[model samples]
Target chain A: MLKYQQIASDIERYIEENALQQGDKLPVLEALMARFEVSKSTITKSLDLLEKKGVVYQVRGSGIFVRRHKRKGYISLLSNQGFKKDLEGFQITSKIIEFDVRKPTQEAADNLNISQEEDVYYVKRVRYINGQTLCLEESYYSKSIITFLNKEIVSESIFDYIREGLGLNVGFSDIYLQAGRLNEEEAGYLGLEKGFPKFYVETLFHLTNGQPFDFSKVTYNFEQSQFFIQANGPL
Target chain B: MLKYQQIASDIERYIEENALQQGDKLPVLEALMARFEVSKSTITKSLDLLEKKGVVYQVRGSGIFVRRHKRKGYISLLSNQGFKKDLEGFQITSKIIEFDVRKPTQEAADNLNISQEEDVYYVKRVRYINGQTLCLEESYYSKSIITFLNKEIVSESIFDYIREGLGLNVGFSDIYLQAGRLNEEEAGYLGLEKGFPKFYVETLFHLTNGQPFDFSKVTYNFEQSQFFIQANGPL
Candidate 1:
């Protein structure tokens, strides 16, 4: 390892051993340089590396302090998989707000390829991780295709029920994400102030037969989480 | 097409014909209902669909209004491609801030898999689309692999020079995104107030030989743009 990397690793170890929390300041730059037997430039480079990793941040005139590592929420845009398997090591729960057969709105009807006269199962849910509400999801499912759905299924992973219980094949999805200020009701459910920035994700899920089955709009608290996606290259 | 969809399409056409600018109020709900000979619910649903599609936004208690369609900038997370092709319709330009070889910081050295003693080509550019500064990019390249770079190359597309001029194969990238407040310098460059929300993206680009070549951090104006990704599913 390079000198600065070695120093950065040592500092990370120190942070761990001392159980430093967010906002806790590290040693002064001169003191760190002396302790590590490095020049001021070397110490600055190490600190810069730490800052880049989001482990520590600088306060300009004050000093370098630890940053709160916000727990990230990941959604694999590449796969039509259930969140149950992806969020391992986290306590995940869902609260079903509404589950009833409702007349499909024009948008939902068009996306689901159903007639406006048809009734779709509308399920609204709030997802939580470790007791903190993180996302509000409003989904419209075609009752004609997804024939087995209830409040119990809605509370759990609906994707699992569709694939395992109903023995159907789950296919791909087309998703669009936008950032916007949360409306009043969304802010209330997520415990955010009105007009707080939120990420709105619109997903259209299809089955193996190439029929759209579900259309969902998920709003996430932008401050608490992020979305991850990977792309392979031909360009 | 559904009845509401037809009405929505007609409304979109009307907006185009009138060349309504952003913040321009649409016709009153009652007027639209009477003109289309549709019920209030139908007109309301059509407007709701438009809002969801991001064509227009509603102001509660006032009326539905035309939303300025913000031109979206696309960065493919799955590919190590340049933005030149993606932003073809817009007038894109770059202002080179700094272009010279510099000793790699520890983070850059590790990401580019280079020795800290070796100098690397460092380039900083403020990218503008249609005369509006949208992103600030700071990129570091391995001198051994790239072997040739200058301000002229930085002003155009560096990826194009790497692939076309150097005859190198561009490969995949590992990207991480976080939300942060703009620092003083960044705010000055983007003309944003300090502490304004910004999207920070860190990218580590690797060649087809699995050797790291480029490390870049792009800070985007949060309120003016959004990042998009599409995923195909097998999982």
Candidate 2:
């Protein structure tokens, strides 16, 4: 890692371990330079990268503070081609079962916060981690974003394209979870018997501007996967 | 509604409208008594109810305070009838397609945080809501808890009986959501053509004392149902 990257991680660790709540200023540039034994320019570059990555923010005369919220949400681009970074132990296998551009259904329209007849892109893929079938994801994107997609892009993480290439940053999502039975086609694809129980989730992601960016439905096979959500209640 | 209930609603409305955050103390009893035009006894009674309901809490020598967290989690009763409370809104037509008490498999043992071969109650139910198939729920419960359960209790909202009568609460849960295709048995239960997509969620609830309580797999028919989760990420 670069010297500046090490500084960034050091600062991140300190923030995680201490009382550096949102809006708290960090040590001055001279302080960081002395502490890390790095050049003043190196410290400046590190803080700049952190700001660009949304890890921190700069206040012209006030100095820097940690971003109020860290990487709290994600816009996942589930695909067969290993995305930008793969989960260490998980191997992802994706099969594009369907891809089409069609007028949004009422449900899709409501999710995207658009008119019902507007065009949307529907893409479906099945993912396997390790050797076990894990999940199936069906993504719905507004037609305005369809221009950014192509068949070749489908093979990689669509999220990478949307972010690095298209400059669309996905923020938090409203998610729901429930249980239901699988239909026949899904059963065959997931290698399970018909009438088996499955897990389901629906998600709506919004951009930083609070506009709907993507909607998706996902299902997971029984016995092979688990979920973890941190509960931060009313407070 | 009772006069006290109205007073409670008024307080709740005031809190919301004024954007009062947790830890903010309520106005003094005399002030509330005058403002709401209710008897001192009535206002005190309303506050008492809110405290018991886990909506608010009081500290000795200190005034009342809003609860920082809503203690609204699950309670799994041993009885089948206790399942109705949380499982409401679904015109539930349930068939216990598979039910057993057996040694925990490796995966089950790991999820339940129990030793291999530990006894567990495995139950699978296919639920139909509104005359349409809705979801399938598969659950695993530790034998210690299920020993208190019976066929009659399994048919209802198990959460209610455990909470109301036994005082056992399923406190915090670490939930995860993903997407996947239905396997054959699940597909048949929901009456879907093969490869049809659905939503999937896997949940693990932990007891207040930090013991693993239950692991559940839920699947929902995409055309009919959606799961909802509200998140305010680590603030």
Candidate 3:
């Protein structure tokens, strides 16, 4: 990275470490220069980089201020880590409705790369944050890959269990993000009217070995979620 | 890539080239084996790879069939290619509502990395598919970088003009996908009711050199659009 780029990132981290809120003032130009031991032009270039990213902005007469609205409200690109990991720091909790090992449906068998005769773990849950319901989720796991599952595991982070306990590497997912409406039963659980708008996300997750292990459908309360994506390149 | 993975991708392309539909049958194992000059085991392995990806499925006693439903109803991962390129083959047209060189707002100046008094190419448009309105788009382009614009260029593709004509590399974007309710004016353009749910996409597009150039706001008609995302890895 260039000197300005490196300094720009350090100041970004400084804003985060200090937990700067929107409209909060950053340190003055002279202070940043003294701290970084850089020239005025370098400091200005660094601040310009941050300004371009909408991380912070300069006021002609007053001072520089934090501008975080553009940075927030995004679902980051690395969402394959699972929502729990993706939305870390939120008070997330899951209520398991059903968990069972049953015969795979033909569709599940194909997605999980297993035979219909084989068993697969089926799980259904309601996800909440701060005791407010947010989503309804259902998933099927390939028994050959996941090996085991219980209420204790389902109540918390299954992605963590898959990565840490099973010692497996998580890979890419093929996902479909659709706009949908809630049915009567779903509306009752979510405290919304029937036909409320929702985001329906279906994913087929693969292990690093390139075999799929899980298929999930999560319907999120649209009002409570803002999906974010960061994209790069024509390639 | 493994031989099977290679074959799996080829079969995926074959499905597209053949324009196969859901539940449509693929070539039999014997035919595939002969077509690729491979053994029956190799052909089956390739099919297994396809099955795991939900590209195709096999019946217990019957033949394999296309499973394009899981594949379609999606926008692809290469959406950075711009929506027109992303949704290729669709009949698309754009109606120019507003286009002019104007002063940037403070927020627009911050996003475009230009001074508030600087001239910017302001564009407002309505995009349609098969004459069905799908989105309302507005953008501000830095005049310093874009250099030129007109009705002809704006009517077709600014992304294509930026790359092929201006010889600049299009870089990544920071995007926030929010579910918003339409106001009266927007609803009129989209033929939806006031308070109709829509996908509000805000993007800051940069050139490969890392300078932000285009700041765009697009409100999509949700019922007519299904946003697709494919995610990969913890990284």
Residue-level lDDT tens digits of model 2 in B1-235 = 6999878877877876887755578888899999999899999988865653434555545577664322122222111232344356545567777787877777667777788767888878887766787778888888776456665666666566566656775544445555566778778888886556666656666544435567788776766664344332111
Clashes of each: 1, 69, 2
Give model 2's TM-score for chain A to 2 decimal places.
Answer: 0.66
**Docking band of candidate 2:** incorrect
lDDT of 3 by residue, B1-235 (tens): 6787788888899999998975688888888888888888888989966764556767656788776545443455436655665567777788999999999888889888789989999999999977888789999999999999999999988898998889887865667766657889889998888877777778888775556789998888887787665554444
Query: Which of the two candidates, 1 or 2, achieves a greater lDDT against the reference?
Result: 1
Model 1, global lDDT: 0.75
- TM-scores for chain A over all candidates: 0.67, 0.66, 0.69
**For every candidate, what share of the true interface contacts is present?**
0.35, 0.32, 0.54
Candidate number achieving the greatest TM-score relative to the actual structure: 3
Model number with the top DockQ: 3
TM-score, cand. 3: 0.70
Q: TM-scores of the models, in the given order?
A: 0.65, 0.46, 0.70
What's the lDDT of the predicted structure labeled candidate 2?
Answer: 0.64
Question: How displaced is residue A59 in candidate 2, in Å?
Answer: 39
Question: For model 1, how does the per-residue alpha-carbon lDDT over B1-235 read when each residue is reduced to its tens digit?
Answer: 6899889989988997998865588989999999999999999989966754445666657777775423356544444556665566878789999999989999999777679998789999998878888789999999999899988888987888998999986654556665656799999999888877677778777665446689899888776566555443342
Model 3 agreement with the true structure over A203-225: per-residue lDDT tens digits? 88876445679988787777777
Q: Which 10 consecutive residues of model 2 chain A have the lowest summed lDDT?
A: A72-81
lDDT of model 1, residue A225: 61
